[model samples]
Target: MTNNTPRVALVTGGSGGIGRTVVERLARDGMAVGVHYAGNKARAEETVAAVQALGGRAVAVSGDVADEHAMSDAFDTVEREFGGLDVVVNTAGIMLLSPIATLDLDDLDRMHRTNIRGTFVVSQQAARRVRRGGAIINFSTSVTRLQFPAYGAYAASKGAVEAMTLILARELRGKDITVNAVAPGPTATELFLDGKDQAAIDTLAKAAPLERLGTPEDVAESVAFLAGPARWVNGQVLYTNGGVA
Candidate 1:
């Protein structure tokens, strides 16, 4: 199921702050992109339009990342539309913060379902369907290393992602596909800045040795490397933070 065709990439959460940047970057890299969105059809359409405006090929696909059948269909659509599947970037995730002692079990379950189970589902499809020479990039967080006080559950979910990423790379032995995770620290995305006050933001901004928060494009660069040229860098987590750890 391999051919010398133009590279194709499917990016989950392609309408998101970081994911949108990744989609555009890959398009600029000359790959046809399938922008997968969980629910935000309008934003996904906007993303597709942005790519098309740039004279790139793109389509918007909708599916829940945690649903095996939905993701399976999403993959099929991308392969059908783009002629083949090459790179898959799973950036669809949710973060819910809570201290361990007072954590709501329901919140934990919801986060795990999206962050852990959703990643597994998407990775499963990527492993089975991505063409040879393809790449599978998953998202983790620097919070796992920072171990922030209220991030216990969120960190646990990403820990599972880190584990699966390494193991899946080994499982795909003999295939030319690369599997890796990108861990971004305090990136300046709506998801990270939504509820934080100026004081909190300032404190976090100074935490990194570079003395500033990272942008979505900063993380997207790491993803771009793994997806295209970083063939030798596999089964590892690349932290895109400014030496925060």
Candidate 2:
């Protein structure tokens, strides 16, 4: 509220691939950033260090995004350290592939807890704290539309996110906060490609119209636009797939 800088923002899952890229881009854009992580202390710290190295203000805060109290504390830390809140980018998600018939309840629950519940907790917190003209950006995936085999659970989880974002934007009608979701195509992160053979990866590459995997940075740019300048784009799901689906 005192400088040319717009406002502070928080990026959940800040230690992971897409999340880390989002934190860096937002920080570079002159917003104080809170990098939230779950159990990846070293990586989160490294993310903070990298942002600092780039002359950006940032800090790492650890908490499970699914827990209400923990998410509350995360925002408390962000407001306390960075002055106040303005934007939120939720990139925390888990993807476990399994046939619906063979899917373990435990795996299903974990994905829901982190991807669906986590998104709710964090978005709720953002709704309460972010200032007027602030933004809330949630992560979805192009997989929901692609409907690839063995990705039912993952797609379902992101589907929940898309639903949440749509309603939250309508619910916040008079508040000046724009809520939206970004669904990226297959990205070249360890999490996205782990355990896949070269042949499998090559097949996936061919599936995309671009004939390659997406990079975390590619997705981050979309996030940056939603959080910074795309104020009118509320209550929409922007799928950043290379015309795949």
| Among all candidates shown, the one with the greatest TM-score | 1
Lowest summed lDDT across 10 adjacent residues in model 1 is found at 1-10
lDDT of 1 by residue, 114-208 (tens): 99999999999999998889999999999889999999999999999999999999999999999999999999898889989999999999999
Displacement of residue 243 (Cα, Å) in model 1 is: 0.3
The local distance difference test score of each candidate is 0.95, 0.91
Instruction: For candidate 1, report its TM-score.
Output: 0.97
TM-score of each: 0.97, 0.97
lDDT of 1: 0.95
Q: Model 2 — TM-score against the truth?
A: 0.97
Q: Give candidates' CA RMSD values in order.
A: 1.3, 1.2
Task: State model 2's lDDT.
Answer: 0.91
Clashes of 1: 0
Q: Where in model 2 is the C-alpha error above 4 Å?
A: 1-3
Candidate 2: the clashing residue pairs are none
